[model samples]
Target chain A: MNKKIKQNIAFFVFRLFSLLIVGVLISILGFIAINGIQVIDWEFLTTAPKEGMTEGGIFPAIVGTFYLVVGSLIFAVPLGVMSAIYTVEYAGNGRIVRFIRMMTNNLASIPSIVFGLFGMALFVNKLGFGDSIIAGSLTLGLLTLPIIIRTSEEALKAVPESYRTGSYALGAGKLQTIRKVILPSAMPNILTGIILSVGRVSGETAPILFTVAAYFLPSLPDSIFSQAMALPYHLYVLATSGTDVEASRPIAYGTALVLIMIVLFFNLLAAFLRQRLNKKLKQH
Target chain B: MIETKNINFYYGDFHAIKNISMKMEPNTVTAFIGPSGCGKSTFLRLFNRMNDLINNTRLEGECLIKSKNIYDKSIDVDELRKDVGMVFQKPNPFPKSIFENVAYGLKVNGVKDKKFIAQKVEESLMAAALWDEVKDKLHKSAFELSGGQQQRLCIARALAVAPSVLLMDEPASALDPISTSKIEELIHQLKSNYTIVIVTHNMQQAARVSDKTGFFMMGELVEYSDTKKMFLNPDKETTQNYITGRFG
Candidate 1:
């Protein structure tokens, strides 16, 4: 075979590999959407599950997941953003900083199930929070902390150094320059990171499983201390350990569909915010 | 008035600027001319302590503005910077509107009176000779302006703070000839109100806009004299060679 023919064959192999991944993703999404669409309805979404988790809606699980997401964001966003700022701006490339960065990367590489176990020991048992919404949110926040910090640091670093210099030349102090220039320029990227974290927090079942997930709770959680049903855990229960797994299959599909839709909504929100911020930043 | 006394600056053991002493009178344009990496820009940055941002930098000497040692422990660097403004080689308007770009210094300094900020923004733009072209679109983005206009806007931003000294690091080297002339004319007009220290590679630009000139070579101030004498009758052979286009 000639060089051109060999090159063409190599290119074809790479194309096939790419298509294989895309094909797998499309097939999974197609299966979920097809099986899940039939079971979704206004009544099913708004009401609590009934008849041994086979007949009613997953309203309480939806509300519980919403609370978990909001709670995790509250703990995670500010802490993540501040950590990123300190790492990127305040901390020089010293030995300590490098060690801290390495630790963060290692935390990111740890398995989600390990985070679940840690959360179980720390928040659920030692902290005496038990299997509650607050514990679960905190666990999820921990699970996603590395992602948020790394992404936010990248975002802050992406802001050009010139903007800081311009602000400093005008007699703005470090804080003033960061607040008035650096933060605004990096806002879009930071939002993207937060959105990604949100997706991760919402879809996670392992961390919450041991820390906060309830086997069967149909009512809305009234406070942080209350046990709540989350979408992922509810889906897991319906598909695996339910009294009648065959009858609960549709509910499981619907729960999966709702979880996917929530993530999609957050992704859309991030894109919209990025576009709006870019426009504002560009405006004279 | 500004003066530096036997200044020696080092960037982490790299001797960037050698022993140099020079004085600049208030309300006059003084220009420093040299080739790249000759430390003309470094010497200019010393006035505002802009070089402090770099790590492992050392300075041995006093930089004085109006008889006050700016590098003294008691001197507030931010206050000193406010009094001495700098414009870079490239136009760096804040990612803000024209009005806000000019008003940034005041806002950062805790100036909150709306009328005062608005008045100062207009005055600075007028001083930079960019008012008429952008007067109607004061709220437009600074990036929308042409290269020349953006540089003028940066100048306007520096002027809005009412600094006693204005430093330009090749402010017009990034512009076309017409824009360069405009900046030169603005500098000439500005000298009545502010002391100006400019660094440029363009010999004609130094001769055109500066009252006094300092020629630097290899991080050393080779000659310092009136612009006319330096260009017409230099005392040093190296200065003569440089000005006559024999070599940089």
Candidate 2:
């Protein structure tokens, strides 16, 4: 019943929780940095793919991963941001709006593999997109859409009500406030959503295998109609498809490290943007 | 001039404002003074139809601007908002450059000429008494300003569009004494070019700045008279008791 005793207990619990989170992140970072850097090489990064089960490089896969992420961003940013705008700004608490909200929440929790399956059925087969870069990109786009939408919705929501009031008071229309005030304010968060989705897409294998097809193509796809290779699919091949995997062990760790690095780079970018925005926002 | 006649509003079957009617003169300042939940804000919001966003809310009466029924179905809500600007208790500047924040109104109303937008932004800032502090940093983000500066920026933003009526909801409530006085002086100067309706709980602020003051209590307009009469010679004993700090 002592007040000091209660306060001390609360402080201890807070420190304990903080330590738990920091401990986990530090452990993961250490493991990835230690295991991944040993196999990473400039040759591995620059060299094109080879036919030998042990001699091949992940260049095509890396390139394909880039295309997939860029493609998905192209597909998702406009639609995701627009949907968030509609939900936050335009549509009120109506049945149609509720339905859209319900669907978006449902979509967020569905596994990436399910999205991959959906992509296979819809784009690769039903829609006749085939096992091309476009199909894979579309599938990945679908996979990332929910994440982008949810995170972007949160970002848009976090913009203070005063900003909206200020814009509205200025005689700006609903769209004008959203476009000029709301969206710009929420942009750093939206960019984080895009970066996170890119990480998820680059590391996924099962989805790409079904839609992108695991062919050792000599050249990059010249058109959307052309099939492509990706880093995750190549890792899967070297690890499982009876390739020279004793040597491929380092390659897998190296590839994992590369994926982690790319994700970290984007994460760093998001942090930088958040810091800059916060410094400016604190003045007012 | 803005006027409301026999206005009644309900929120989900609960009466929020009942049979409220008043006329606000042009080129002067009016203050809405009342306890919380007395519908001063609701009444202020009605001028620009900001209550349209509220769910399951109903209205029955006429809100007129210059004798034209604003509630008439054909009236464009967007155009009306352009003429009647509002400011909230807290300062909220866009995460944009000072120039952009001031230019936002002109841009929204289809003014695309960059030269015109630049000139209007300057005039609005000058009108709000914030030009000197921010003139050199027009390109800096509006959010980089201090709290008082942000509030003034908001005023500039509203004045940029040349709105005839300015509805300020406790604009100085969030400011320190110095900032609050600056806003009061700005409001005093602004009344010459724009009709101003300010809502305040501070009796001193209402007495100091308002030409006419409306006292609201329990969703009713208890007193509406010249500020001098309302504060000095009281008609209703309830108004007298309130002014003397008997009850909020």
Candidate 3:
């Protein structure tokens, strides 16, 4: 065959491979929707599970997941954003800075199970928190810290240097410049990073499994020290370790569907925020 | 008045500005003319310490304004910057409304009175000769303005803080001839109030706007004299050649 024909065939193969990945994603989504859509209802969402983990809803799990996400973000976002600003804006390229950056990158690649073990040892046992919401939240926060810091640093770096120079030349101090100019410019990207971390924290089961996940909690958690039922762990228990795995299959699919929907909702919210904030920035 | 005494500058041991000395009178326009990489722009930035933002840059010799050394540790850099405003070659209006762009300097200085900020913004815009065109659209984004208008907006921004000195680093180099002439006209009008130092590659522009002219080449001051004499009867052979279009 000639070169042009060979190139066309190669391009066709690449396109097919790309479509295959999308096809797989759609197939999985379709399978879950078919199996899980029937079991979803308002009552199912607002009430606790009934009759030996086979009947009612995943309400406690939903509430527990919400609390966990909020708790993690409260612990992580400020610390992550501030650390990013320090690295990107204040810290010069010195040995310590390089070492910190290297450590963060390494942390990002560690397996989720390893993070769970670390969390179990540090927050759960050593801190005497036991299997509690705070332990789980802190663990998830640790799991997501590297991601948030890296993304936030990228966002901060994306702001043009001209803006900083302009602010400084106008006699604005470093803090004022960051608060008024740099933060505003980087807000949308930081929000994006937070949304991504929310997705990761919500879907993660291994980290919460060792740190805080309860086998079956039908009621709402009253305090940070209470063991919680997160969606991922709930789904995992319903599928694998339930008294009747065959009967609990629908509930398992329902939990998975709700988790996916929650993630999708947050992603949509992030997209909306990005659009609004970008418009505001441009309007100036 | 501004004076530099035997100033030598380096970028990490690469001597970028050789020993150069010059004096500038207050409320007069002094222009530096040089080819690219000749350190004319670098010299202009030294007035406001803009070069301090770059790393590994060092300066020797006193840069005094109004008989006070600005680079002294005792002097506040922010206060010094407020006293000395700078406009760059490119029109860098912040991504803010035209009104905010002009009012930025005053606001940063803790000026919270709304009426005062409004009045100062107007006065600065008027001084920059951009008030009439933008008066009706002050709330609009600064990016919406034409390049020339944006350049004038930046000038107005610099003027808002009421600085005694204004440094223009090839202010009109990026502009069209018509915009360039408008800027030149504004510079002429501004000289009655602020000390103006401009760097330009356009020799004609230097002659048109400046009262005194300094020629720089290869990071050294080649000639310094009154603009009329510098253009008419240059003392140095190199200055003569440069003016007569022999070489940069």
**i-RMS for every candidate:** 0.9, 3.0, 1.0
Per residue, candidate 3 scores C-alpha lDDT tens digits across B135-245 of 999998898998899999999999999899999988888899899999999999999999999999999999999999999998999999999999999999999998888
Instruction: Rate residue A58 of model 3 by lDDT.
Output: 94
Between prediction 1 and prediction 3, the one with superior TM-score is: 1
Ranking by DockQ: 1, 3, 2
Clashing pairs in 2: A61-A230, A61-A231
TM-score of each: 0.98, 0.90, 0.97
As a TM-score, model 1 comes out at 0.98
Every candidate's DockQ is 0.82, 0.49, 0.72
Instruction: Give, for candidate 1 chain A, the lowest lDDT window spanning 10 residues.
Output: A212-221
**What DockQ was computed for model 3?**
0.72
Give the winner by DockQ.
Answer: 1
- DockQ preference between candidates 2 and 3, better one: 3
lDDT of 1 by residue, A34-124 (tens): 9999999998899999999998899999999999999898998888899889989998788988998999999989899999999889998
Model 2's alpha-carbon lDDT is 0.84
Better of 1 and 2 by lDDT: 1
**Model 1 chain B poorest 10 in a row by lDDT:** B239-248
TM-score of chain B of each: 0.99, 0.98, 0.99
lDDT of all predictions: 0.92, 0.84, 0.92
Error of 1 at A108 (Å): 0.6
- For each model in turn, which proportion of the native inter-chain contacts is also found? 0.75, 0.63, 0.59
